[model samples]
Target: MHPGIIFFLVILGSVLFHIFTPWYWTDIASNWGGMDDTITLTFWIGGGVFIAVCLFMIYCVLKFSYKKDRKVEYKPEDKKLEKILTWATTIGVAALLAPGLIIWNQYVSVPKNALEIDVMAWQWGWQYRLPGEDGKLGTTQVININDDNPFGINLDDPYGQDDVLIQSDLINLETNQPVKILLRSVDVLHNWYVPQFRAKMDAVPGIVTYYWFEPNKIGEYEVLCAEYCGIGHYAMRGGVEVQSSIDYKKWLSEQETFKELIAKQQKIEFGNKKIVKNNNFLLNKEIYKEE
Candidate 1:
């Protein structure tokens, strides 16, 4: 079989496989359908280049194959060809990059009314903080962190008092509402990724990163750590549930505030100390009676 013929067959098979493939992008559940469009445009441009190069190779294989009577030309370079190639490459790269830049601009520009949520990541878990009725997230720092204040929210900041803390793996959002997620990391690097949202960002230590998305559908979406931080990285999973505004509010209402959590911890420690004191008093009385 001729090499040119084999290459032609390869191209045909590639196209046929692509058209008949069962794979496709996941359903767009957020307002970022533009992201999908941008990706598809990139695929078309890259696939076209691939097919063109393959066809050109096949053409050269058939047309320029060594022949007993033919002599090869020794042309060094073509100025016109070089200019055409340069412009083609520039246009191709621009076409691929322009949409991404536009989308990125919109991604970083949070709407004024978008709800703010803080996502804090650790080695094997996720924690969340949502602004209370104040509608403003308070200041936080790594220095203020402890087992009680896992989110590192400043205890001195009055604004942090009412901040709802969710230590569980599930986060709930209102459907059709824009949400700006502020990402943070307490221990190591991690990524908050939800495939349906088409948005993800890094959670760097001592820094806050963010992205926004509006869930257009009501469903449960799986969240995974996209970065390889450690051996337990694979188990660092979470979830997001998009629900109606009423349900979202109800869920939020049930979450504990930062102030409440601190008070609860204090009460537990006090009770433990009281029990120990009573036990010591009883032991001293028994010793005195024995003497």
Candidate 2:
């Protein structure tokens, strides 16, 4: 019936449950395993504090319970205790914040050899652009966007002509190669996240964001939008397949270039116009004969 005993039991149960829980992180396939280390460090710091505070409360409850004949000591404050608490709190906070800062620095620093890829997110789907043999992504703007040119890649920019466009959600990358992913959003705000890679960044409507990672293992990773956007937000899913260099190259080679896509669209429109002109001519000739 004692409150102290119940507190002890609660702490014990929590520790046991955490130790025996089957839920753990997925296998990391990228070079950002340091992220896992940072998380573990945070868990230890937070969990340790929880356990210590609860145990201390239980001790006070048991030791100070209903002393019928004892007089309570009225000590205002302890200067030494205050100093110790202040320094301890400061150190704990710094420990938690320092690793995250270090990781963020590395996350934003792209290597010179890192291959650049553009990821565009919309309300219900994802699109990608890869630089062609030139290894440079073309300039893009929101004003140039249309049904035919979804990426809004500049038509007048010669550099954009050979940019490879992937209309589908699937993307392929070479294993053990570093890549810098540029994130953009057309309709609403979204986040490009893959758990196995342990890297994610937001795609804002007006500005571009980016993160870098190297897939050291060959596997397929599922991509999900971490931010809530609209009704189809739950269905907005995609994938990334890391493969050998040869297979990656083969897949890239099959993708359509920006210029090729524009030309194809023009041809289809031209054919439709010709058909309409022929139909009008036939109708006019028939009316003239009747008259």
Native-referenced Cα lDDT, model 1? 0.92
Q: On residues 1-291, what C-alpha lDDT tens digit does candidate 1 reach at each position?
A: 999888889889988888898987678799999899899899899989988998999989989999999997899999999999999999999999999999999999999989999999999889899998898888998897888888888878889999999998899999999999999998889999998889989999989999999999999999999999899999999999999999988988999998899899999999999999999999999999999
Candidate 2, poorest ten consecutive residues by summed lDDT: 16-25
- Candidate 1 residues lying further than 4 Å off, grouped into runs, are none
Model 2 compared with the native: what TM-score? 0.97
lDDT of each: 0.92, 0.94
Backbone clashes under 3 angstroms, per model? 0, 0
Name model 2 segments beyond 4 Å from true.
Answer: none
